[model samples]
Target: MSLIRKATILRPILYLLVVCSCYGDGGGRILVFPEDGSHWINMKVILQELHARGHDLTVLRSVESWYVPQNSPLYTSVTVNPAPSSEEEDLGPDFFSDLMQRSLALRKMFPLRRFLEQQKDTMAMLLTFHGGALRVISAILDDAVLVNQLRDSRFDLMLTDPAFSAGVLLAQYLHLPMVYNVRWINAGEAHMTIAPTPPSYVPMYNSQLSDRMDILQRTENFLRYVTIYVQERLVIVPIYADLLRRHFPPGADLVSMQRSADMWLMRVDFVLEFPRPTMPNVVYVGGFQCRPAGPLPDELEAFMQSSGEHGVVVMSLGTLVSALPKEVTEAVAKAFALLPQKVVWRFLGERPAFLGNNTLLMDWLPQNDLLGHPKTRAFVAHGGTNGLYEAVYHGVPVLGLPLIFDQFDNVLRLQVRGASRVLEAGTLTTENFLEAIEDVLSNPSYRDSMQKLSRLHRDTPLAPLDSATFWIEYVIRHGGASHLRTNAYDLPWYSYYSLDVVVLLLTPCVALLWVFIFVCSRLCCSRLRRKAKQD
Candidate 1:
């Protein structure tokens, strides 16, 4: 009788686990790459839910990802090895962190060695970079195709940092769906996808900015253009650049390799983004926030509580951006010492000489939980998109101390929207740092504004992840993605590539010049005739 009762209890618990676990992403061969720092951590929630639903999924993640998905939702990994080491030209952790910006995207028209530097300035790279290890792991993941009843690839979905675009393109050549999950700053290319002209809320792109492309953005755009046109059509050029050659191709340039993405796996809640577009393909799956946020560590919990009502400030530049000079670290240490509130900074280096007991510097921390905690008053952050979404999620006001690249833009966006405070990294006096922190923390208006924006952010009709899933399923349901197709081919380079402004400017100017030249020749001829008559 006791055994019968035990069986009954066990069966229900098993079924409940199954129900909670059923994520439903399905077994239709999906390949995902999220090469953006540890921001790949966000996908843990999405994948777990997918696995519970009994979907066959694989992850191309960091070599350090075993801890992330240790047991529950089994997924494979493929790692792109860090650049080989050398004493002559080595940039450590910071370079690797910002390598996405520095390196020409893997999919650029040029070769890898051309844009790919020998080493990045990441301490993480210095500690963990083993090319042989990554290569070995990659070789194993390469066989992901054969592991099945699934059989012969359906479509692959790649979602990674822009630096990983070359890998995305290679997968596309294998006839897989390529999608970039907005883990952090959407690369300049992806930002251009939803280019913020007039109507879009993230107004980063405009004619004004275009006129100010700073040599770097223009260079990035040019490489992208060349990739799609010249590189994709290498075998066909000049006379051979004929469209007819596409029909005669045996070992052609594989225009199929030129990936036409169906949509982006925008890991942001549409609720957060205002003035959202009404596009068919774009979907928001952001705020799949904490499936992997297993439990808060006890010391972090104790640390927050021990601070009394003074509250605590959490400082981190996300994972990738931690590589900075000792001078910057010293300035940060001095600033933290000055804060009345206890500060916990996730600095991935040794305890600086300038630091004090008021400061806590560690390699890593439970970022989201700290933000969620009641003792958390203000976030002194690097203004990463993930951090932006989190702070807004909890209604915590931020002191955005942005240092490099998109961080400036991200914080600037926050500052303009009344959602964040931006501090220039270089010129920060400790007094200035404390003033910014104190202003945001003590100012009720800043908190109130953050609260209002938080509500506005969450007002989206659909969760970002749901929208991401909808598009993902939509593509697999409709083979090869015909619906998202644009008549981009029918348009000329000036029109198709949207260089029509150049065409418009040149055409009328050339016509007027021709007219002036014709009149000048005719007048000269008449003068010569009159001179001959006089003679």
Candidate 2:
């Protein structure tokens, strides 16, 4: 071959190498489902971030979570299921809701044997999950990789979010590592579960601490947690069994199936928590806030700009709890009318009549973008954990009107942390709403306090995102997730539940009873002997 021909071949190969170098990198069999709206956003943010860092993102999305009531206790109300009504009754969403509500209420009251016997039809429908759970399971099973997202603690993992049991079973059968995350406030936060209102002010909230009842009121609160633990097992075990029957015919021991978890990543930071003991498995990464803002839409940007007198107060009850019922809307609108500042509320549906000229209601708003604005003063919200992070990230104060599970807890935590005030839903009238809003707005101290907490929230040695990236990369390189797991798994449920005490107590009682019987028999024998001698 001539030198001229060799040079020509090398030139083409060099050009190809340059093109390959310019176009960077390789990728995961990641399967993600955004069944919940905010959850979708959450995954999107992570997906984008990961993609930027060279990841193959596979997101299974549906309109749920932050936008709708799909993931909560109320989602099934929109579905349709039928019972064999006189061999001809057809069931609609309304019928499903009514039937579901009755059965759920009954499950609370009935013991296992009674519930199983009476709830045959309801259980059949619930297990079938014609609404959507089965479909999600099928989708997950079909995914290239199984990523069992432990976003909620349903049956300790994704094992039992009611109908989603099938999804959990599918993930397990595929040998997927359950990725645990705290999509809400840290459960380990010091007994913040106690009622928010002072015992004396219980009348205001129209409630009483369930634990405050007399002996007959039932010592259930203490036992309730343990009962729930058992109940979770009962629910998941059956579903697991059912799925195994239909699928994993080879079978798996229950203990081994339960034991399999690759890693647990906490979506919370210790700064957000009220100081309490936490296990090693519980990685404290509360700083994993939503990805920061980009450009805002033109309309949203304009809506946020106003004079000092017209302040922006963002009110959203989150996606699942979006149905603000007419009364709540009117109450909120009336409260906004009372406030001197203009309110930009991300309200769903038609605007309320009580909404004043100063108030602007829209179906959607750029949440973090609005908060990041300098004029934005305070946030009135349902106290979702993600929302709390947004407010903190922006150095804004908040008035929390919590309506459901853990919302009240988050509100109280904010109150205790001096970051916000809790506005009880029962007393959430126009006056009370304005009062709480005014308290957060007028009080420079509250703003300063929140800003202080915000500073603390961000005062890490490394940027939160950087820290998260480092740990994730380290895990991938080392491939040793066992280092992150807690010793809680090693201990038996008896030790965790302290069933040892019951055994100890029963042992002493048995010994005492035996001693009493022995002494009594000896005395009777002696008496008989004396009587015979006398004769």
Candidate 3:
């Protein structure tokens, strides 16, 4: 080969070598701090992938860390004692249960307005409590011994899910390079600070409004948006400020600490979400937790096979909600018994008496495995993003019973896209539940819609895991990837949107219009005077 040809052939090879050399075989130590319980499940795939890539990892254990299997990789595990007493164990569960019970209390209120009004009361009560497990964990990290130990560990990077404020605070305390994996679509003040989620167009969390809204819906969404600041400003900000004053370094504030994160791996994609402006620091890694279907356990396989031509339906309400209310369980059980398809439901505590011969109950099931199976017809779920993304991955239609948080919004998006129907858990009835299941099962359109969305979801050139891993390593290689940071975070809302500029430009136009009006009046009066004189 000629010199030019040889050089051209070697160019890409040389680049690859240089890239590999930069990142190197000796990967840096990574510390992962996921909030307790199901939050860990969301980050499992990413952390597992990172561990497989030879990065040294230290994972702080919440009570939920016991779920990690013994055969897992050699990552260092530390169980943090946030409180000396047994009380800390209950804090996480209590925080969630308190919010849920308060939400459920609105059932007696009878109307949407009353529900929202009662919800505000719940928020007020929730804000007054400062002993949440996440806050306690942050305090534990602030302990002098723990802080000194973490600092001495010389961790090159820290990864955390910012469900609570602790992750950001902990990162700030340790002065480590940080990356956040936010597992929600609309991360309250965080997205508002980094991205422009216009309230008129983008729906607020739990608002139950679609992307395209009518006048009333837009007004409601705007009102909801305004209320979001009440919690952020009144509750989250003040508490974190006190935490900073009490435990963390003096120089850092919440906004700056949050902005300092190198990259935010968000669990959202354009396939399911409305198109909106996003900053460079925000990366959409929606299906990071989804995986190819593995073989089901023998009994499950046999059960699926027993469904015959009618196929099977899988129902799961996700990890946080282990059991539904007794009446709700009976309603779901009644609906499932009527279906020709076999049903596998995830339930805890006790099986309802109404459960039929065609249905099976388990405290846990291999959800993704069942969804990917050919015999699976539809999914009945709580519309958690994790489950929704898996359904999208496997091309299964959904019947969503949205109970709380962003589940409502997830189901709303699914309904808009013609992939699912939603029923409010509080007001759900046996008849409505039965009709929805039949509609999704009997109609081919739901399946077709889901298939189309699944195609779009998987059509990206790189798989989500690959994309996430690349960016994560990229951050490590480049020493925090500071170039991706946007100046938008530094600007005030009015300045960023250029409201002042709009007023400034409009001033000249208004002045010119007045000048023309005055000139016209003067000319008319002059003509009238001349005519009068002439007369």
Error of 1 at 441 (Å): 1.0
Candidate 3 per-residue lDDT over residues 1-535, each given as its tens digit: 8999999899878866865676676788888877655667878788888877788888866433435532456578766655442453344544554555555556447567664775576465445333353445665666678778888888877888776666667777777788888754113634765677788888887676777889988887887787776666666667566666776667667766777889888888889987777888888888788888999999999999999999999999887766777888899999899989999998886778888999999888999999999999999998888899999999999999876666777888988999998877777789999998999999999999999999999998567876787778877777696788887757777888899899899999999999999999999999999999999
| Full-model lDDT for every candidate | 0.56, 0.53, 0.78
lDDT-best of 2 and 3: 3
Model 2, 479-507: lDDT tens digits are 43566665554668697567997898899
Candidate 1 lDDT at 506 equals 94
TM-score of 2: 0.65
lDDT per residue (tens digit) for residues 270-331 in model 1:
44443434344555665656322334678777777888878999888886665445666787
Give the Å error, residue 244, model 2: 2.5
Clashes of 2: 9
TM-score of every model versus the real structure: 0.65, 0.65, 0.85
- What is the Å distance of residue 384 in model 2 from its true position? 1.4
Error of 2 at 18 (Å): 26
Clashing pairs in 3: none
